[model samples]
Target chain A: MKQAKYGLLLYIFLALPPVASLMESVMIVHMHMQLTLLVLSGFLMGTFFKQRFASFFNNWNQSGVPGVILAVVIWAYWMIPRIMDETLTMHSIEIFKYISLPFLVGVPLRDSWKKVSYTVKHILYIFMTINFIVMGWIYVAINQQICNNYLLVEQRTLGFGSFAFAACMIIYGFIWIFSERKEHQQSS
Target chain B: MEQTIKETIRYPKKLLGVNPNDAKVSLAYLSVAFISLLIGGLLGLVQGLERAGLIELPSWLNYYQVLTAHGLLLLVVFTATFTVGYQFANLSHSFGGLLPKVRTLAWVGFYLMIIGVGMVVTMIVLNEASVLYTFYPPLAAHPIFYVGLVFVVLGIWACCLGVFINYRHWRKNHPGQVTPLLAFFAMGVFVLWFFASIGVTIEVLTLIPWSMGLVETTNVMVARTLFWWFGHTLVNIWYLVATSAWYVIVPKIIGGRHFSDKLIRLVVILLVILNIPGGFHHQIIDPAISQSIKFLHVFMSLSIAVPSLMTAFAMFAVFERTGRKLGGKGWLGWLKKLPWGDVRFLAPMMAMLAFIPGGAGGIVNTSNQLNQVIHNTMWVVGHFHITVGISVVLTFFGICYWLVPYLSKRKLTPKMNKLGVIQTIIWTVGMMLMSTSMHIVGLMGDPRRTSDTTYGGHEVAASWIPYEMVFAIAATLLLIGVIIQVYAVFHMMFLSPKGQTEFPVAEPEEHAPVAPLWTERWGLWTVLLLAVIAMAYVVPIVDMIMNAPPGSPPIRTW
Candidate 1:
């Protein structure tokens, strides 16, 4: 119940003008914050949704595959260079971007992730890691303006941010694996 | 006598434990790639000769037409087809066997690609589409050319889908198991290809209608932007697959253990993510976009080098490890201890050596200030030749030397094997001469893509003559090398004596029963990927749409 309140607050914060503007102005922040942060909020929202509507989600996403796949697809759609552009220029897209990310992708991802098999969860994680690396590459490598509104330095900053994030994720994975192995050895 | 003949002719049920059907499918893909290689090689010779001013291209066959065919055949058709074939083999062998349905779908993709290549090649020959391989319009090709490219992309997508399905099925069946490294690499290649091709797909959809006069004009910058998006990723697609062979196959061939599995996975993951947006680096000189964006891309371009750098380090580590195990003592003794006589090792090893300079040259090309000095010059041409030409093409040649024998259930003849080593050496020497001269003359201000450099005997043209002569010599050596390679591959495929074939699988230094679970989580990684892409591209693409200049009608300069 406490988590649900925090989720609502986070959602409200993301919707605020100052935060939204900052995200839109800087390419890296938009990617690292507006986009990634929204998903994180949705994950929080999923915890709330699970607590409040346990039976509803369980019945709807028994295997969690559909919900997870939906999250992935929605996330992929936003990644398109064109869609990124639209979020700034078109009002409808901007609203949809905020709502869909938290409610649609974030909410569903959290709900499905619990129900998802160990194997499926691992696959999803790997896929996300690769996606981050690719996005960083695009941000840094492209010479032309990918986003008309943002400056070039912002794009490069975002590119570096992407690499840093990816590195952190990999390090986390390595530590996780090391710990898991050590536990297994001890148990055996 | 009848029994002996029957035994000799009978197809093996399993090649490298892969079903005969799967083997046949892989072989079919390779055969098409090889055929394209032959055609592309001949065209390259013609291009070199014509560029050197030694031979006149017939009036009917324009220089640009040949250049278009050469680039398309070698870079697009040959590299893609071979990578697909090689990946299929790797996946099947690694995973035990692919589903029959997956194999069938792959065949469908194979035929579609062939048909597409056939259509495009025919149009080029007929002089209906002389637009260079870049096909950046305002210079429009025939509608058929665009349609043909669409088919090729669709075919590749179809193949990717099959691989995806097979991978999913494997995951379902083997719960809690990590995917094999080679299979993981194949999946990465297709996924990257699928994403990278989206830019080209948009270009084709827009351009096809315009070429057919369904649209009266097309936005040139928009089209060029889309093409570059696809173009840069396309090169990485080639490099990634060859890198896979280097990581998985090369170490084993030299009797070295695999590099750290975690590190390799990290490298591949980095490559797939970083490879795409770097395409904008190619368009730095264009006035349609702002300099800030170009500057951003320059930074992104440098990041793409990370994977290749990782690869270089890992490759040397593997070699050093192997060399020391074989009793080499000094710092450079391992290099001498390597199997220099074996074409399988030598070709790719030499190719790796060439990439150091080639990759460095690429960094220079991407630099905003420096690019002005070399953009659209023969220097750019020389850079790619060392990369795609020597690094990628030579690596593929090495793969073929072993792959053909494995598929055919035959032994490469001793004489032909020796000749294969000779062939690689010839290629190395030829590329050095040609690329060196090309690089030197480019700094002297010779433009690329022009048929004639004379320009009514300008003073600069007189200075270029010596380099051109050297290029002619290099081209001749390269041609001889191509002939020898083709002969060796064909002879191995058909006439080599029947023998048992070996598939090299590296034994890891420290074997773990199962890979870390997080390495397999493709779903999460994919979501993150999209977000990053959105961050990189959304603003610029929207800006293009909102501020687009009026479309330009087609013009045929040729």
Candidate 2:
């Protein structure tokens, strides 16, 4: 049933670009409608079906191999265009593939994906930490390009937006790591 | 079902650590925050006077100085002190048994934040840092301003660390245990904050090097990108933590179990994930970003409305059930069962009332087309003050009043308590009036961050005269309410008779029934599912990194 919904939503969504050219005065309007519908679908699924979908993934959890595979496929798709000079909407295709890649991660790992076993938890944490470090580096290097030769120093060094988030995350990370250690100490 | 929940209960007498002196410390933060507001308020009055072309003060006490001080002192310093003080009280009760370090850390953090506030104010008065509270760049301020802000962040970081340590200690002592829903919400805020800080930290650390001329140059886009990473997300961090207090306090007061505890926490986790990426929605109008990128952020921003809507659904459900259990019938029954007369109940109720308008404004602003109409206008200010300023700030006050006594072992003076409720009611109503007026004028094309003057001549000026008058009237009412709240809380702490204090009561949970193990186990997985769903929108976006259009702006290697 969920599959049907996903299919229908995608069909209507993908059909819009072609549908848009038919309209003279409201071509942009048609394009907007197509785009907005996809967002609406995402919102409804996240809010209503999150539990069912997440549990389904957990039931099929297999150590993120599939996630890595999906990532490889998307990466290969990008590399093929670069290497072979294939004619394609590279940017559009990239976004579409990224949007679809989640099904790879979501479908096979339903109920069992997020088990609280210490190993799985640690892996997730490490993954997130690495992502942050990478993003942080990207952010730092891009300062000149983004800020126009203005260095990014200020009080509350992280700034209001990022500091609040990082502060929250740091607190969360500290709690998780610290608690894990404490539990280990007790068990030993 | 009843027996199941009862069986999981555990109340430890040893954790009933109540110190009377803590009340004084809590009061001190609130008092100082109020005093800051008072000063800011007077500055606002001057601004109001200046708006009418009636400048009683020297021309040197210019609009820029007042505007900068009003924003920096009132919003950052005052609001934070009040919120953090409430947090100290909450941590003492929520994790009193699980973690014990929060109270000590809170003391240190509170003082650090105060010092930070003092320094910022000094910079403001000295005309050294006039970039306003918003640290958006190319408009850098004095080095002392940055240093002071670091102290503030450090202070907040310490407070957050305190919460984390306590949570960890608690979870360690009780392995495999699911955290209480409220504590999870609080912890989620910490999680969001830690990551959110990274962006600003990048900006600050990177900028300082160049500002001090250590580096040749800094990237403006990168800095703004990082700033918004902090800017947009911090708004949610403030709201999420403050609202968690409401989630706990509201249900208890209404006399019911939370409608769906498992779901509420999931919403919170979703909020954390969705918030991080959605911030780019603010930068949609920037020329450097491609349409697809803006399109992506637009979708993400719109998607965020789900969690908020879910929250409303969940909260209203609890209220509905509470109404039915109280012997009321139908949709209206829920309204009847609510303890309307009780200040504890009324304050949060009013806070919720304010959220409705703010939420509507939020949805409109999140829409790409709609945002273009009101972005960077008084309308934006109206929307935020209604959402974060009123909803979150009021909730902070409600929680303080509700939980402080439990932690401090002293009842709030009854008269002062009454006064607090009255003040909140006035403040909430006044805020709506003011913000609504702001939206009207903003739509009429009034600009933000100005003293109401523009280059389009007096035609634009004439349209604003009535709105400005209405705004002044509303501001006066709001100021009175704010001052009343300060006086009431202070009176409860310092001037109230000490002999009437209530001793601590440690309720025995040994005989209480425990919630079934299966229920708790299921709850944990449900929460985990929430996390997974939260990331679905995000994890896919990672694909954007590898697939770029030919001749697009290339991502620089770090």
Choose the strongest candidate by lDDT: 1
In candidate 2, stretches whose alpha carbon ends up further than 4 angstroms from where it belongs are A1-188, B1-17, B20-31, B52-57, B97-102, B213-217, B454-457, B497-558
Tell me the native contact fraction for each prediction: 0.00, 0.03
Candidate 2, residue A47: Cα displacement in angstroms equals: 22
Q: Please give each candidate's TM-score.
A: 0.77, 0.72
Model 1, span B252-364: residue lDDT tens: 88988888888888888888877777888888898767666676678677898888898999999999989999988888898878888888888999889999999999999
Q: lDDT per residue, candidate 2, B1-558, as tens digits?
A: 867543322332334324444454556677677787778767766766565444555755657678778877777777667766555544544555423245667778888988888787887788766676676556666667777777788887887788777665555446656566556676777667766776677677766655555665556666667777777788888778666756776777767665455566667767776777667777766545546546656767777788888878777877777788888896596688788766666777777778888888887787778888888778987787788668876776666554545444546666767777787778877778778888888898777777646355587777777776766777778778767866665555555554333322122123444332233222233233333322322222222222322321212111
Best by DockQ: 2
Interface RMSD of the candidates, in order: 7.2, 11.3
Of the candidates shown, which would achieve the greatest TM-score relative to the real structure?
Answer: 1
